[model samples]
Target: MKHLPLFALLGGMISGMAQAEIYKYVDSEGRVTYSNMPIRGAKKLDLGPAQVISSPRRGEGGGNPSSASRSPTPSDFPKVDTSTQKQRDQGRRKILEDEMRSEQQLLDTARKALSEGEQVRTGEERNNYQKYLDRVANLRNEVTLHEKNIQALNKEISNLK
Candidate 1:
């Protein structure tokens, strides 16, 4: 029901474009309406002469996908020399290697913490073994997370050219 006005407006626009007659009306509730068909208390709307637009024909406007894909880069586009690009790649490799080293250190620390945590025993945990298990599980998760980080860093370093 709420879309009636939008539909009416579109209908009026389409009819107007076709040089067909349109009508406008305001009901007792003061809601405005537009339509191609006449109704009681509706007034003829003067939507002037139809407007025409023509689309470009085929390849005239870069519309061919094959030709577009083969288009050369613009003259003003920036270009990086082979040496500069190689230096950038080398720098990226160095950064990735440093990150891999850092992640390896973190993984070793996490593993040590998990190992120590697994061996510890407490009076409270003796009566509630689940608590101890939960603590060790958290430590294990930390170690696993660090290991995954190191693996990802190694993969990233290996990918560098």
Candidate 2:
């Protein structure tokens, strides 16, 4: 009866060993491959004995595989207090608003300059009208640059949470 029990155990062990076979291969590019099913040129890898690790089943305290692969956030990471963050945001908004106002003033002045340049011709411009046109163009570009700056500042302020 004892011999019968030993024979059954041996048979179970043999079946488990057969099911645990793993094959390994290297491709032409030197990348290694591992698989349960044998490939044409794969060699059977003898990994001694399989190690079994028992874990709680999913829905019973064991985390899902996706959660397991994610790294846990560290407890000691720096965090800003809500009030301080709000204050910083307000300060940034104020600075952007001030800059936007300055840009708007500069844009107004540039537009006025462009208008005056278009209306009046200088001594040099009387010889070549292109000179007056070029001055007007430069003034227009300055106005455009300031307008763009104001728009960017407004966008930044609007994006603040």
Candidate 3:
């Protein structure tokens, strides 16, 4: 019975992958739209054949089969010189640092706002504690989000060569 559901899910996924004709049309308002279903005045798109990548056979590798099947970079692929790559890495680091500083400022602002919000009680919020709590919760979430952004920025900056 458990396997039946799994089979059904797999069947649905396979059916969903069936190719469908795509059409593009410009509406009277000059807006362009694309859909699988043909519409009046819509023209069928001549999309090239879909690219297919074969799944790695089971037991191909003891660990990750995909890693074993991974292809090396093509000979014609573009390459960046060491100096250019270093310059790009420096630029990325500078951008990440600037972002971290802005996030820190936002975190400080959010923290200050949350502290102020928690202290003040006025009007309906004084009697309705839930409303006050909701406001404080939103402020706290903002502070948390900013803190997380700063952490991510710091991690990215540290990863730079």
Candidate topping TM-score: 3
lDDT of 3 by residue, 1-161 (tens): 87999999999987665445789999999999998888999999988777897755666653573475567679999999999999999889888988888889999999999999999976989899999999999999999999889888988988787
Q: What lDDT score goes with residue 5 in model 3? A: 92
Error of 2 at 42 (Å): 42
By lDDT: ranked, best first: 2, 3, 1
lDDT of 2 by residue, 48-149 (tens): 877997776667656865465445668998889999999999999888888888888998998898888789999999999889888888988998898888
- Candidate 1 residues 66-121, lDDT tens each? 46545578999999999999999999988888888888888898899889999996
TM-scores vs. true structure, each candidate: 0.52, 0.54, 0.63
Return the lDDT, model 1, position 161: 65
State the C-alpha lDDT per candidate: 0.85, 0.86, 0.86
Worst 10 residues of 2 by lDDT: 64-73
Over 4 Å off in model 2, which ranges? 1-75
What is the overall TM-score of model 1 with all chains considered together?
0.52
Better of 2 and 3 by TM-score: 3
